[model samples]
Target: MYISILCFGIFSCQDLNLEPKGMLGGPELFGNEYGVKKYFAAIYNALPIEDFLYYGTNSNNAYRPDNYWEAGKNSLGNMSGEFFNTWVQVDNDGFAYWPYDRIRDINVFIQSFPEYQVNYTAEVYNNLLGEAHFLRAFFYFGLAKRYGGVPIIKEAQDPLAPVETLEVPRNSEYDTWKFIYEDLTFAMENMSTDIDETGRANKYVAAALLSRTMLYAGSIAKYSQYLGFQGEAATSAGMAGIDASKADEFFQYCVDAGKVVETGPYALYTRGYPDKAKNFADLFLDAESSESIFIKSYDITAPGNNRLRHSYDALMCPQPDMSSFVGAESYPPLDFMELYDMPAIVNPDGTPVRFDHRGDIRNGMEPRARGTMYFDGDVLRGKAFDIQRGIYKNFDVLASDADQGSPNAPINNPNNRILGGRGWTTEINGTTLNITGAHGNFEDQGGENNGWGSAFIRKYVDPDRATSDVREYRSDQHWVVFRLGEIYLNTAEALYELGSRDEAFNYIEKIRERAGATITRPALDQSTSNIGTINKANYPYSIEKSLQFIRDERARELYGENHWWWDLRRWRTADQVLNQFRHRVLSSYYVADEGKYIYLDEINRINRSWTASKQCYYEPIPWGEIGKNRNLLPQNPLY
Candidate 1:
């Protein structure tokens, strides 16, 4: 250790003695600009941004299985219904944050800022102060979303205070939201719009968060009655419900926030893009995209943190061709797959298209579905990923066994499916061909992959880079936090909720247009091609139908992007949508005799089911925290 000569008071040693506090150098060190910057670094390190580094309570570790889910690969996709994990799990709605020390830093920053020795301009002071407020509000909003209401600690609590004195009671849910609102309003007011720092929170970022969080609060308030809000504290202290009159107020907050953000340089991500699919696919990869409102930049230059960008690719990319680092832990479920518009049998009129041919069902679907998911025949890097369940061998017994819900090993056998580097060779008509579309092999450890029939998960894969030589573990693309497309959807949803139905529909149409979706079926690449277009019908004007459309639209628009889990919860439809779902069949087979493909074999596909209850909607507060603070008594209902 080196010692530095310091004159606490140059005028006199008496001046140093005049200081009432015991420490002289300590205060001066932190009161300077560089000292503040060092403190800020520590604060930044603890912010609950929850982008890539976030890990849920018990998710599987992708790169390091001996460790917990640090990289959190495919966690968002698996938790939401958009994709399935290779290993089946009873999912938990996680709120993996309890950052009190960070908040303490924010409190100190807010209070002790004026005492700093350095001469900071008013703008610098405001920006620093405003950022603190924004972080505090963002952090608190996350708490409110998970716990309904949490203790509001505005001022720094006295460290020396007795435990009894520190045990503050929990605030009501409405109060918690209002607390967040107050902090955010302050932040938006004081923060500068001039700064263009990537990954740094600014006035626009605060507004965007306010827009989203306020919408959540307003909706929870308005729909609590509809969504089953009946709890002891709900009526007592507004813990779980807000007054119905406040719905419009909060909705206006979201609307106003959106308006503020929309006026900026932000816009949708679909201009100069020749096709809709490419336009949609490239949205997340493009770092300079005006669509991104708040971004967490990940470049090859980010020191020692290559894990941030690479975790997602390692978890979501297809297993067959992808590097060994990948887990292949995500694939769209059959029900989720069916939500896309079919390519075949165009809904020329505004009506639902019925499934007449099972084999050809996946074709002719919505263009957005193509942009969102990887289906059975999705090609990547010039590989077709030929995903057929079984070849037509004229042997009915094994096929029947597949229907009878037999163990997957037999179906994975060479006699049944192509196995052990072998293709099923058979003579058909006058020619001999080896049909090699079968792809599956479950992992015994069930860590890396669980051959769930190659539907190959494909949402955030980079199109610009050739995935052929890609696994450096640096996913290297920015994860979008907010975007103008989402804002448009939020505006539509808010307008509808606030009784502006026509306006709502118009906003929805903007998104549909950007997506290349239309009132009727979308046109195909070629007339003869059976591949799908946006197969669904046009919006009907009824509010009920419009609401349903919104539900489907959200699922389609935000699939695998980590938004569905919250959507289902906020809509109060978690119990209904997530309660019991069936994976009845693994992969569908084709029937050539009828000159049609039979995709579903309902007779043999015994139910493979999943269930989540209302309780799964809210996360449980840590038992340790509750035990430590008796004031947090009567733990969140149903805990």
Candidate 2:
């Protein structure tokens, strides 16, 4: 009988040895409880799908909003088409892969997990199931946001079977949102209130994601209010159909989430060591900080996988100063930098006084260029001729030969650019102390004229990632998928949108308080102005003004943490903000050239890099995916 069973299995099943393992062996492998735990861990690894900044976002220290894009490149820098074409926009074509890859794993785990005979405490079982549900919802939420009507698959399926049953039609955005909300609600109820590692999502993290998802949906449902705004996006088609009124409901969710995290044991990173100068940037460098909610841990000792430090070193390092500057070509554009600038101070008489251009400093009003790079006596006199090379390129000449400077020992000497304690100064305790760039330092490279600009990215970079000036690899610093600060920002945005301006300001102020910024309340709070019912004066830039202000604060606070492009897109002015920076950077490169040197290739690259074409506004559906599931999905307009 056993022989007969085996012989019958050979004819009925594809592989006799692997048969009775439950349909393609899926059940056999996943039926074990231990396997289920490991599978869930993989899902957790995929939460933040991409590190959007390093490859494309910071090309010009502005927002590129596409892959194949670089800071000064004109054509989305399509050196490799994969990054430029698929990675840049939200295309349905590229959309089918990663989200489904994760979903399929989760679905398979769900199907296989039920059959396993494993003892469980209520808390442990609930948390495990809750985590799986949260991940499914999270993946779905991302897909829904990117591709509106995606197939909702909740069970494992036969790979050989026609994808028709599996090919289920696309669900409505509202329906998808409902699923996400339900899943997150389940997670909030079942998951542990506290997680040992900041990298894992707890109730608060789930709540934060819930708030973020709702905010995206609510905005899409309420885009009608700002239809009058001039731009390519003025038309309803440009927006993903977000409504302004949805702000109220969505922001309430954020506030609720914030309350959970606020009451829970999470704190902002406020500690510093004896080296006061290193405090602000240290949180990112350290692996174990109280404030890091979720982290992508790195081991420099590991092979083939690093984090963001390489990218940071490449961009932040200046040239020819032995300060680790490979190509100081991708600095922040003026428009983005200006956002971090404090608003003009006003007298009681209402006259506005421009604040002193003290420059960008960690603690004071100093130019960022000053502290970030140096070109002074020590550099020029001691090592100027020694440091000159093809890549370094005429360091003394570039620094001294500006339109007003001199090559000879006459007026406008290059000596002024030398940065050994004299090139740049940092203010500490009301004292201007000088810092030197001794052998491969980040600070003390020359500024603007010497290939230096105010543009810098600080989100990720590990000292251990690379040895040379060019940090062209991944960094090991953990990426914060969800941080406490974002919860505060989400709450503020939602409250403001919901006509709770006072409440919104309170939340916004809380973030500002954490960041150590001074706040001033509006005399007659205009929080109610943006709601549909109010007949208030539009105040000409008040909505945009406040919104932009908050956006900039988030950028400065978050910098290279990789959220600006998404925020700009959600706010529906990506084209405007990006184009402004593009033009400004192009003009700078041009102005610098009229005097002498030319980097025309760089110019062309930046000028023609990215466009807010309709396709970019909405990503195309993958051709393969549409074929598999024909009922529920269609390509987005333009793409």
Candidate 3:
């Protein structure tokens, strides 16, 4: 059965006979290689690739929607406790992302492309068919990750068909992932090894997809039972969790797929030599980076296409100095900053360590942390970042005396602490001093356009754009979807889970070597525990200490790349990890008597906390879909 394709006419024609040039019919679209390329472009645009322009409001704005300049404010980083921001919190219920329309478009191509096989050679025909299979698998992956078991719709159904015939039931969770595996396997077997045009999938790209998706599947298989939903309807029916016995099979699949990707012509990016920090920072801005497995390009040249440009720079850097627009919206939290090897901000005696200059905090910090964030005195666009919080008069007590910057602390008296808004000044002993830094910690102002923490997000931010040109919708930096750095991390985790501990750290060392970490290769510890050191989350099931290290490494390497939320969900630890999690900020202060600077840990001004419920592991299927097709009933586990 086939659904009729509609083509609307713009002009009314009574007697005039004319051949329409505006739209192409089925044969004209699928008959030639060029025509098929044009057809595939639309499908590529509708993919579930979450890039810089993704707005997390609802399904309509999920897939790179146009004019979504507010993404930086409400980014996945802010919502998942990766960064501190005032705009969005953890939304337990997802935006109901069902993309059957896009799936139907691909299904039409798969069903109809064979009719034009005579127009092309056998190799070209087979490659195109394999590309279609890869596309279908991508849509299924998006569904399986959100709702555990969605209906498997391979063929396009007719709209006029009987209701009973069209209402397909949901497949089991294991079967849904198996279907994705089959499609990706077909893609790997038939797709060409040669690179396709930029932004298109090749055999290597398909393998990268397989590597990531199967890792998620392997995680679900191993950790779903720990969520304690064993007797629920979805769990009992095998719709929400996979059997624990299948964990090794899925992990092996992930490891094998990663090995295939390594065979391709790709390597970790190392363009800016000698300065490992600069090299790491340049990876995201370099368009021809060798580390990039697949990337989605954005352009500012197109006049009216809002999706072609983003506002990352404008929302990340401060106003009047770095950006001409709204200014910084998200700042790095101290919790994440401590994940890296930072300098000693406090002495062994529990007193705050005073630095000759505030920028001296970067002296012994990890180079990767330096590359990921901008500290005081880090210059960009001809202006140095001055991120001091306030000034402390006379000798200071232990850091605990400040009580995390609480207002009720005795040391926080107005006479002892000098806090002010942006550009504010105060007179002291015949001289005037600026209260807050030029960029942040404005006590009188809110979080909007103010740097709430001591550091700013530098990942994926364009450094070369002139301040005058840094307006909303004027910056165009490509968002990398799959890079070699991430592939290495995926392989390392999968290998460790399969009990190959030594081989896992081999991959971890390579990543740390590029970032110039202090301990490039630490001795492996196989001791098992369920207590997470980062958030102190108590997991229901125990894992090896080396495995937890691999997980933390993923957070450090993939910071601000929009992977934290999904990582927490896939591990079945979101509820425990984010239980009333309050992001902390590092505040810098100038000592009036000692003429030095001190950095102390403090809670954010607003005291915002993010919490995720147990049900956040799996989103409920869209209620509207169940209304139309009752077969979609057993709506996810909790909702």
TM-scores vs. true structure, each candidate? 0.80, 0.67, 0.96
Off-target runs (Cα >4 Å) in candidate 3 are 1-22
> Model 3 misses residue 206 by how many Å?
0.7
Clashes of 1: 20
Model 2 over residues 226-292: C-alpha lDDT tens digits? 4343232222332234345454565566567667777767676666643322344556666666666
Please give the distance, in angstroms, between residue 434's alpha carbon in candidate 1 and its true position after superposition. Answer: 5.1
Model 3: lDDT to the true structure: 0.85
lDDT of each: 0.60, 0.46, 0.85
lDDT of 1 at 143: 78
Sorted on lDDT, best first, the list reads 3, 1, 2
Model 1 poorest ten-residue lDDT run: 1-10
Worst 10 residues of 3 by lDDT: 6-15
Question: RMSD, model 3, all Cα superposed?
Answer: 3.1
390-449: candidate 1 lDDT, tens digit per residue: 443333333344443344645434454422222454554665543435333232224354
Overall local distance difference test of candidate 2? 0.46
Question: Which candidate comes out best when scored by lDDT?
Answer: 3
